[model samples]
Target: MQVTQTANKNVLDRVFKLSEHNTNVKTEIMAGITTFMTMAYILVVNVNILADAGMDRGAVFAATAIAAFIGSTVMGLLANYPIALAPGMGLNAFFAYTVVLGMGYSWQFALCAVLIEGIIFILLTITNVREKIIDCIPSVLKHAVTAGIGLFIAFIGLSNAGIVVNGATILALGNLKDPLVLLTIVGLLLAAVLIAKNVKGAFLLAMITISAIGMVAGLVELPKGIVSAAPSLKPVFLQALSVPAEQIFSLDMVVVVFTFLFVDLFDTVGCLVGVASKGNMLDENGKLPKAKQALFADAVATTSGALLGTSTVTAYVESAAGIGDGGRTGLTAVTTGLLFLLSLFFAPVFTAIPTQATAPVLILVGVMMASSLKEIDFSDFTNAIPAFLTFAMMPLAYSIADGIIFGIISYVVLKIATKRAKEINLSLIILS
Candidate 1:
């Protein structure tokens, strides 16, 4: 047993270079588990959201897990980065609500758009255009991106836990008297306290604590079954490829495909920038290493996800949680991928982990990541204004791509107006 264990460790070390990244097996595994626990909600949420577009719920469920597994595993092996990928939250809404329901296009048409976008992404990565664009982002804006994502994540947590809700006032606090909200507050406080004590795996511990409390308090329902039969993917599989050639060449197709390409490109870039900065993975030039491989993995996931009858698969900002938990190597991503595959059979149990339980984890990671704000140089008004807009627009506009778009345009306009065009790169001008 000891020799077998040593052999397995050797293989992991060679593959992930865990020691070189200064992370061990136990830490990476915990980080992966923490990430999977927080992100597992995508399985059920993606299915429900896609179902509105008239897709099969069971098939979408299967697709979500399979896409996650493929994306995360490929990211681990191809790029050796700890980041995990999944069907992105905002992208899915646009696929279902805007493209399919609002625009009256079929879901298959939307999937074709997604597939086209993925192909374009792969091409961009191959040409190094994507990596160059990421590098063109100014250092201050990169830090702002991290802070913006932190705020965005925190807002998501608050809204998910019903601690924040829309009102005539635009935003208002939830009733503290409500049992669920009260429980959320308890979890929030405990997480904060754990973080203060410098506890290892504080976020994971908080989630577990809240889940247990909620179950005992009759808030979180227990799963009906520990394991279940896997769902078939046949209903939605390869439907994207079925779009007629005439439809594919239509103007509507052009517009839809462009929209998908634009959104996925920037959202993935924002996620990579935000989470990489939070994890201190970027170099002095504000560039991530092996970015081509990372991006290629994302592109492949999107194409596969579309073929499997889902929306765009992109790198997730939630990955910062695992990075914050000491995940520095691909081992973390591989572990998360394995869990996603395992979740296929254990869907009920994974789905039963309430949003309230993961709420504290998201909120805490937000606080931790927001420290990047301190790194921004507020002394320069030119930098300050764009940076502020970049971070603010994320949660306010409820879109990471919008935040980046606003920031880049403003930065370029400001620089050109101020006669600092020499400081701007050609890529920046094109991006604007």
Candidate 2:
């Protein structure tokens, strides 16, 4: 047993650089569980979202897990970054509601566009074009994007926990009298206290504690079973390639493809920079090392997800949860990926984890991501205006692309108006 344990330690130490990152196997494993608990809602959420496009629920559940497993594994092994990738929240919504439904395209055609977009992403990453784009983004704006996503994540958590609801005006408080909302409130306070006390795995412990309370309070249902066989993916896998040639080559299809490409590109970049900043992974130049590999993993995941039957796979902001838990090495990602794969068989147990249980983690991680806002120079009007817009528009517009677009446009306009056109680069001009 000692010999086997030593061999396992050697491999983890060598591959993940755990010691260099000031982490260990135990901490990485716990961080991985923390990250998964916070984001496991995606399994059920993805099914509901994609099923709107007429995809099979069981198939999408399998695809979501498999795609996340593939993306996180590749990211861990290749980039050695503690980031996790999954079928993204906004991208899936766009795929189903915008492209497939509003654009009158079939689900297969939408998947085709995603596949093509993934191919384009791979090309861009390999040629270093994506990295160059990251360089063009100003530091202030990067901080703003990070803070904006923080708000966006927190908004998602609030909505999930029934603390916020769509009111007749805008969003109003949900029923505080509801038992679930009360539980969420208690969970948030408990998590805050645990974190403040510097409790290790505070996030994970809070989740488990709240979940237990919820179960006892009859707010959360116990799982019907501990394990179940994973669903088949054959229903939708590679089915997009069978679309009619005419439809595939249509101008409308081209527009749809561009939309997917555009959203996935900026969203992934924004998420990586935001999450990496929280982990102190960005260099002085505000660039992530091995970013190309991360982007490539995202691209490959998107393609494989479409082939395996899901929407655009990209880096998730929820990854910041792992980083917040001291997950500084790729072992965290590999651990998260393994958990996702294990979830395929233990779906019932994971699915039983209620949203309210995870909601507090999202709220807390959002606070951590937003902490970078202190780095932004609010004294400069040109920088402040765009930064403000970027931060505000994320949760308002409910889309990362919209927030980024507003910020870039405002930045260009402010620069030109202030006779600072020299600061504007060709990349920003083109992007604008």
Candidate 3:
């Protein structure tokens, strides 16, 4: 009887401990869930693109899904941070549409770019050169980059929502006549209302709920939710890595890989810094903990993704959505990572989530990201000019790297023109 009583007490103690963890760890889990939902669109588009590229669609999806899961889980368990890693949206588009379609490069050669760039990224991380570059960036410019990402993401949300459609002659416009567009507008309004009313998970909840209604009303195309297992690694992995020596020596390849490296680095850095700030994870000196580990994790994830036959993997800015929802610690990221892994088996269900649903979430995230612009020092032209370039160019240029480049170039130009070139950091000017 005494033994039984002890066992019961032990179980109760364990339960209490778990309850405590849940209470304290609730933020991380919420953040992970929020981030996962925001990025779920990748599962659909990625598979389709791979299939069109004459690659094994199922294999690519399986690989990407698995790599993302593992990378995200490790990042959570090892780093105690809430960033996500996945095949990058922009890079993949560039690979399929630009490299394959425009440049007429073989898919195999494109894969070579992924491998080389990833290795370079890893080297950059280990050498501490990456850190120095980041440190050299003016605090104001860094903030602008972060804020610019917000604008860039917001533009993505708008484009996805059909609220803005890109065209050849005319740039873009709202689809006022489309009922689906009307529904999206309504959903956006609903999400805004809920957010203004101070509802927790308002963005996520609104996105899922409204998109479901739109699907049921036959306004949105519902994916059949069918996923076939095409998990081949050796062939595709080899194909992606086998760049000819000649190709590597070519100026064009050099340019492409350099571009890829530059974009991935700042994109990841901007995301980490932005989300960390929002989470209040910055130290007393305003430095982030385990930043190297986070950077290494991202670099490794990209390489692993390439080996597994997917596009470049990088840290996600969408993680901010979860940070805004009160996620802290790697536990939340682990939870999210687990979900992505499980998604391989349940791809159909996730694919069922309509675009209109995600639109509201993206819009909310945009609002959150863009709000940081208010924090920039508007009085100093040095700060304000770069901030403007970073903020405006993101959406306008439709590229994060372009926005960052414009900001960097403008900063250098402004400093030189104002005869305050000496005030600028030498390393930063050189890098720009």
Candidate 4:
């Protein structure tokens, strides 16, 4: 037993640089659990969304788990970063609603476009072009992106908990009388208190406590079964690769590929910068070390997701939860990946977790990340305007890429109008 323990410790220390990052195995494991619990909703949500695109629900479930496993594992091992990757939410919605339904393309064709986009990403990363783009981002904007994602995540949590509802004019308060919403409020308060008290594992404890209460109160249902065999992926995997030759060269196909590539590029960049800033992982130059590796992992995940029968895969912003839990190394990502693998067999049990339980964690993480806003120079109008737009537009527009687009455009316009064009780099001008 002692020998086995020593061996495991050595491997973790060597592979994850655990000591260098000031994280221990136990902390990484806990952070991994916290991160997984917060984002696990994607497994069920992805299946439902893709099924709308006429894919098999069971197949998509297995695909989602597998893609997550692959993405997280690659990120952990290759990038040595705590970030987790999965089939992204908005991109999946685009695949279902716009690409397949609106454009009237087959699901297989959409997968082909995703695959091509991933290839493009790989080429860009290898050529160091993507790294240049990341380097061009102003430090102020990076801080804003981090805070922006916090608001975005908080918005998601509110929507999930039914605290924010769709109104005739805009978003309105949900029914305060609703039991689930009430439970979520209680959970949020409990989490906030624990966080304030500096309790370890506060987020995870809150989730478990709320989930248990939900189950007992009949707000959440118990799993029907604990374990089940995974569904076959051969059917969808083969279908994705069987793209027609004519479709490959079609103008519509080019447009679809460009759309996928564009969205994934900015989304990954925003998430990387945001989560890195929160962890203090960015260097003095405002660049993430091993960024190429992170981008490469995302590219590989997207390609692999296409083959595994899912939509575009990218780094998840929920990684901030792990970072907030003191996950400073890849070991956290590895733990999350391992858990995803285990979840493949225990899908029913994991899917049973109520959104109200996870919602509190998201809100708390948002609060943690929003703290980065203090780093921005809010006194300067030129800096403040773009920063505020980057911070607000994320949740408001319901798209990270769109928020980034608006931020960059505004930043460039303000700089040039103020006759500070020299402060604006050539790359920013080109990007604009």
Candidate 5:
């Protein structure tokens, strides 16, 4: 037993390059725990969103944990980056609201689109298409997309918690005196205070707090068990294959595919560059080392996630929490991955989190993503108009696809009409 333990330790040390990265098994494991704590809210949040799109809550909970495991594990072993992965927030919202609910497509059909998007990303990354694509799209639009999704999902969060409702004026405030709305309000404030204080795992803590209060007040039902077998994946697994042949060629299908691809591309690039630069992992040219391997890792996880019945799995910015906690190697990520695997048994606790309990996280995540808006140059309305339309249409039109489509179209038309045709690239023109 001692010899076998030594062999396992040696393999892990070599495979994760712990010594080379100046990290140890103990530090890596602790960082991994930090990473999981920071982003653990996804187990509850993802299920709440996907369940609205007519999925099984238990199954999505299991799939979410499993996919995060695959994503972070691959990131650790393949790219050797200290970043974890999970079903992204914005893309999942788009999947549920814009594609399935608004566009009137089935959730299975949307999953098919996500699978295609992942496959395309894999091919594109292999051909070195990511950098060129990133360079082609204007930074203004990218910032706008992020901010738009923020506002859009914040709206969803508000709606879910019954803070906002359809009224005589088409939209109105819910009765603040109501129990659910009041609880959601308290959760949001508690989460805000926790975040303001820079507390670790603030979101998860807020959710648990509100949940406990709700249970005592008889607002949320008690769970049967805290730890049990993972739910069956049969409901959501392999759903992409159920997509009809005609869906592959339709105009809406193309639009859906482009939205997923563009958002995933932007998100992956932004998270990697942000975290890598923070970790001093960038090279002399301001490029991430082993960039292709990292991209391929994210792509593979995304494809596998769709097969496992979840939305686009990409690198989580929450990994930055772990990075700040002294995680400098892939072992940190591998540790995070294993924790996600362990979370499978706690699906009952996750699934029991009321919709209102997750509302604060959705709102706070929106605020974080929307910060990109400050980077946009709004001094000129030429750039400002498209940017405004981009973010505005998302919440107003109730569709992220509409937001992207309107932004690109308005951008191309505005630029050409203003004698700035040179600013519009071939890809933007094609996208328009």
Candidate 6:
């Protein structure tokens, strides 16, 4: 009887271990799903740029999607952080629409720029100067960055939903008199209702449900006809390399590099600080474990994306949505990374997720961002002015970093004028 009891105990212990392992795997999978849903918007907009670049549009897209999958997956499993990576929305537009078309630079030259910028980012990560730079920013401005991004994201949602329309000829700035706008408003209200009712995944589920209803009601446009779809497989990369080696080494290369480095640096910093705080990743000192490792992952992802013939890579703030769903660690990141890989097979499906559907998630994100205003030390004008400058400039200046710079300058100026120079930290003043 004693031997039998021992055997049974051993079996139960093994079962418990198996169950624990399964739970971890499930958590990681959930994280990946959240990550993929956040990044789906990129597939819609990025394809247009590659199509115009005189490169094989199909190949460029395939490579981009693949690289995103690889980069995010690696970041999740290795760095164990819940951040999503993809060809950044703004950088891609700048690369394709502005740099290549607007400035008349060749696509090869653009790729070179991405490469150079990515390398610079990597070096910054290795030296840990990036953290120092982030540290030097006034805490008020740091808080403002998250809130400003939230507002900016909400603006993007409203604009995408067609709820904020252009004016007619006379007024030239009135609301658009469109049915799509009305439909989206209805959807927003529905989302609010779901949240009020305590529905889980209220934001995401509301967007999907409303979009499906819109489609059935003839409020949204379905593709007109069967489009010639490309196969979802990896094709030859570096075709641009064959075109001309000499063109890669040009003055244009310098511009591309700087653009990639500058944008990704601040962008990633904002995401890390923003999401980490929300996710409870920060320690008592506000430091995160392996933070430089995570930054390195992001820099490497951007460099890889450029090599894959896409825009500069960036960390997605949408990863916060997963945190909202109870994601606590790297398990969530691994899940997000796996979902990005799976998305390649369902590219067309991802393409079909309407902008209206995603808008609400961003709206919710905006709300989360605005939650920071309470943290601002509004009692002091020195803190208040800089914080206010950062918050207001995000949308008006049309750049987050620009707003940050304005806030820093204003804070320093205000402190000096108020005879509070001693209160100002030398490191912050110098860096700002």
Model 1: runs farther than 4 Å from truth?
none
Per-model C-alpha lDDT, please? 0.90, 0.89, 0.75, 0.91, 0.81, 0.69
Error of 3 at 131 (Å): 1.7
Query: What total of clashing residue pairs does each candidate reach?
Result: 0, 0, 5, 0, 0, 6
Per-residue lDDT tens digits of candidate 6, residues 267-353?
Answer: 777777767766666666566566787888878887777667777877777777666544555656655666556655666566666
TM-score to native of every candidate shown: 0.98, 0.97, 0.87, 0.98, 0.69, 0.84
Clashing pairs in 4: none
C-alpha positional error of residue 168 in candidate 4 after TM-score superposition, expressed in Å: 4.2
lDDT of 4: 0.91
lDDT per residue for candidate 3 within 1-432, as digits (tens), equals: 999977764553353232433434445556677788888878778767765666777677787787788778767766677787788878888777777777877777767787788888889889877766666667677678778887777778788878888687555788678887788788888889887887877767787788688878998777665664445555576676577789877887887777678778777777777677666676665566677778878878877777778878887777877766666667667767888887877777776777777777777777887777877899999879888998788788877777777888888889899999986888888888
How does candidate 1 score on lDDT?
0.90
Clashing pairs in 5: none
| Count: clashes, candidate 6 | 6
Q: On residues 106-193, what C-alpha lDDT tens digit does candidate 1 reach at each position?
A: 9999999999998988899999999888889988888999999999999999999999999889999888798998888899999899
- Candidate 6 lowest-lDDT run of ten: 15-24
- Output the better candidate (3/5) by TM-score: 3
Candidate 3 residue 211 C-alpha distance from true site, Å: 2.9
Kindly report the root-mean-square deviation of model 3 from the true structure over all alpha carbons: 4.3
Q: Kindly indicate the candidate among 3 and 4 with the higher lDDT.
A: 4
For model 2, how does the per-residue alpha-carbon lDDT over 41-122 read when each residue is reduced to its tens digit? 8999999999999999998999999999999999999998989988998788988999888987889988888888888899
Q: Point out the worst 10-residue segment of candidate 5 by lDDT.
A: 130-139
Q: How much does each candidate deviate from the true structure in C-alpha RMSD?
A: 1.0, 1.3, 4.3, 1.0, 5.8, 5.5
Better by TM-score, candidate 3 or 1: 1
Q: Which stretches of candidate 4 lie over 4 Å from their true place?
A: none
Candidate 6, residue 177: the lDDT equals 64
